[model samples]
Target: MSAEIWTGVRERVLALAESPGVEKVFGFPYGGTPLEDPLTEEELADLERYCGVRLPDEYRDFLLHVGAGGAGPTYGVFPVRRDADGAWQWHGDGGDMTLPKRLAEPFRQHVNPEELDALLADQPDEEAYEDIDDYDTANDAWEERLFATLWSDDHTVGAICLCHLGCAQRQWLVVSGPERGRMWDDARCDYVDLEPLGVTFAQWYLNWLTEAEKTAGTVSPSETR
Candidate 1:
């Protein structure tokens, strides 16, 4: 990937905040603040040391040169901060999928995006069966499994939820394991399942910046592809 990608992302990211219907609750009156300044080298080191893993360089550069946390894709990027006890942390989804765990452990890549739709596409519609109880027993097992794993932290074991895209969709950036720097869409809650976008941190961030421009008038929707 071109190293200059982050610079282009910065320009496009500013345009994103102006898009309509984006509920930016942080960094102003009422919500917890978002970071504005670039993180210092020492600060980055402190963060990595606390997390027990080094962040992807592109992501680190984005955090150091572009912006720390506030003002990013959809609901905005998760902020990195230190807690009251002085433990460095990533402030997002306090579930088991998140912090205070072993980060070097490889993340399990379970679902392939291409097969995701087909996996549930065959699910029988409720009205297909005359008896609801019959459908519940025979037709609903796979659907039930989908829901079970949807909320399971194991699905996104080594990734952090970066931003929520509404309608039960969210973007996650891997921090450790085999996909240490890739991004994915976690839509398991809605049965869409996990889909890897095959983009790195810089490209993923660029994806949103570009999408925001397409949404706004500054750039045409077709230009993004």
Candidate 2:
């Protein structure tokens, strides 16, 4: 990608992170680890040639901005989980990694701009769902309750729905709340339009790191590093 395009992508991502509805921005490592499995220039060229499709502008910018693994804070980004053993692993600072579609499932669920707008319009109290487990919640109980109280008159705007495709490593995000149904008898649509990228599984793991950062409440990588 051109330097100008890369710069534009970085600026856009940062701007999105600053948006009122956006809670955080996530970067997944593509290729591999920098120090452990760094991507050689020749290898990158070969892979690009093999793929035929140049990576998206924003995604390419992400690679340059974050480098190959270990470039940013471990938190906020999801870490790669080994399918064989379910153990977590981090990509080194430089490596030949690819972003996998499975890893991006979570973020794509709320990709629909309209749905996202609705979610933001009726944003739930962050405190209410603090205890909800990201991996084991049986239902959207906390979210539903909060939506009921917050948007009692209109539920369609506050409904929450699960992503059908799942997130990185089959993780899920709150795309809609329950109030939209009880109040408006309206069927909620929380799905987004973004397509998932097919890259290395390690990219999916980057999400775990992003979650960790959110827990720590630090912005810059240095704060979490």
What is the C-alpha lDDT profile of model 1 across 46-120, one tens digit per residue? Answer: 878877778878888887777777666566676777668868656544322465455545567666555566657
Candidate 2 local lDDT, 1-225, one digit each (tens):
333433332333343344453344333223443212223445444434443333333333344443322323222233222334432222322111223222212221223456455755654454556565742252465457444433233321211111122232211111123211111111122323322233222233234344534644535333333
Q: Pull out the clashing pairs in model 1.
A: 106-177
Top candidate, metric lDDT: 1
Q: Which segments of candidate 2 are over 4 A away from where they belong?
A: 1-41, 68-212, 221-225
Candidate that scores best on TM-score: 1
- Residue 204, model 2: lDDT of 38
Per-candidate RMSD vs. true structure? Answer: 6.6, 15.9
**Candidate 1 lDDT trough over 10 residues, lowest sum:** 21-30
Q: Given candidate 1, what's the lDDT at residue 153?
A: 58
- Cα error of candidate 1 at position 103, Å: 2.5
**TM-score quality measure for candidate 2:** 0.25
